[model samples]
Target: MPPGVPAPPRPPTLPATPVAADTRDTVAAIYRAHARELWRVLGRLGVPPAAVEDALHDLFIVVQRKLPGFEHRAALRTWLYAIAVRIARRYRERLRRDAHDPEQDVVSPARPPDRALLDAEAVRVLDELLSRLPEAKREVFVLHEVEELSAPQIATILGINLNTVYSRLREARKAFVREHSRHRFLGGDAP
Candidate 1:
């Protein structure tokens, strides 16, 4: 080679291979980050309080199985939300089939008596209002109002268009307000 000639540009070096994430550590991290939120979401989605733990376990089992194939096409929270929704639906259906009454399983946490009573009544009224909504509207309302996800995010999680999410949320809000007013007017306990 001529002394003055520049060496041919080296081929671009390939990046080092990424280490595979440890499944246990990955699952633990995911649980640590999202468990509390998922628990609340499951309960609001109508999983009986007694079964919420089991449903959460089932949701993680699915995550474990599917984690390897996850392509990061959606945000992790959105993916988890989708899984919780399905698991919650299954638990709700099982409860119905078994003729289980969710209210009977309610166990008020230890608190000042007045606070506990008020909390319980508020939860009861909220649940009753949510239950009156159609499932589609309820899901939209919960994801938007409770989870505080934007309509676009809810649409992605629920596999619906953004407009549909907006429509359902609007309807759900109207129903919730109407029912709440009626409950108050009828002398239901106001917390």
Candidate 2:
């Protein structure tokens, strides 16, 4: 038995592979740390708040199971975002199918009374305006403005051109501002 050679460095465990179960704990830790922000991003991308928790859980489950195969060609957050957006899309599709059922309607998140008084009227006005926007414009608007994503990142996430993202953002801003101004003029400021 040789005792002076540091045990030959313990002979690496798993086979050399592109993906390994070895990364699971690290991935899970990163996911836990980043989860709230991820959900916020998905919500700003037009996922109803009601669907956000389930969507995030499902997304992470997929990540846990599939991430061993991840190629690392993109940033981990970007890859997670791609998954989140797909999950949000599926959530929206299901919501649409359930649209005609009264009991199936998605609920808006609850707001505290004091906070609602402070901001509800403005939020209500904005939500109404946003709801009226063309779907593409609303998506870009929320992603860029509410989610605070850069135009290039939005383009990448949505698989759209940068110019398209810019144009949609411009249109969304214009429409929202116009509607807000009108509402203000009409004194629709009650909370």
Candidate 3:
């Protein structure tokens, strides 16, 4: 190193560009690779199935448009999950504004042999239970329990403090257990 020479800027460790090549192929590949998982994630977040198609479509459009800007600081999957959450949140808002639509909505992007949607009874139970949770607690619970992300991973994905993630998980667990216990003891009579 020469005495007068300045050090060069370190190259970014993360990938500097997004995965998708063009908008069309990006949309198609995203659907092929991740649409089903995204739907499941949305379902657990309380996004009705009917709205999921439109919401997911919209999400992909946004992703396509934004892909070039993605710096890949996080794993691509985690980045996609964050996008899904935002899209689902917007869909829920629309539902609130237009209550005239059906109360329960389900999406069947990929049909399993047994069923196209969540078991009706299970969805009903989950929806009912999730309705009682605080928004923060519900999001963490859905991401961790339903989406199957670990706590530390979720904290990184959501860019939240690790302690906040743990706190939310505790609250969610407490609420879920209390609700489940009441249901079992009262034989489904509890609210």
Candidate 4:
């Protein structure tokens, strides 16, 4: 306790707290669990295939930054899908601003040549049908049917009321079925 003695140098501050380590681990686990589904969901949500990978990366970046504050108001998958929807919307807006041709970004799924042709055609038809719906309806349809999320989950993810989800889903289904029937009547093979 000498008055002039310099205080002992503070113990080297640890670079990160255990809480930070826990956050990092949580982020990693979330990525491992949901990355692939989010990638697919992004593409289905209207992120051009060429940009889906970037969209997925951007999604995880947001997750990493915001996840510590996540309140668990919804299931993790629904929360992740909600994030993907926002990111995909941003990408779609950017594409619109850039006047990018999204069709050019469509890549056929890898398979035997014959099956690839069939699947490509099916995908094309489905995309066309999906594009015909209004955005709200399309979102409901894709979330409920394509992503296999329940109405309540879609409502949670889209921040809409559960009844609104049902309404949108009903309208979307009608629109989809109508369009699909037309395609079939036009001699297009049904997917």
Candidate that scores best on lDDT:
1
True lDDT of residue 128, candidate 3: 67
Q: lDDT (0-100) at residue 102 of candidate 4?
A: 54
**Per-residue lDDT tens digits of candidate 1, residues 66-166?**
66555545488999999998898898788889896654655657442224323676665777777878888888888888999988889988899989999
Query: What TM-score do all the candidates reach, one by one?
Result: 0.78, 0.67, 0.73, 0.75
Q: Which sections of candidate 1 miss by over 4 Å?
A: 1-21, 102-121
CA lDDT, every model vs. true structure: 0.76, 0.66, 0.70, 0.75
lDDT of 3: 0.70
Clashes of each: 0, 0, 3, 0
Highest TM-score model number: 1
Give candidate 2's whole-model lDDT: 0.66
Per residue, candidate 3 scores C-alpha lDDT tens digits across 66-139 of 66555535376787888887887877777778874443343346553224564567765776688678767888
The global Cα lDDT (0 to 1) of model 1 is: 0.76
The CA lDDT at 26 in model 1 is 69
Q: List the residue pairs that clash in candidate 1.
A: none
Pitting candidate 2 against candidate 3, the one with the higher lDDT is 3
- Runs in model 4 deviating more than 4 A are 1-20, 71-74, 102-121
Candidate 3 lDDT trough over 10 residues, lowest sum: 1-10
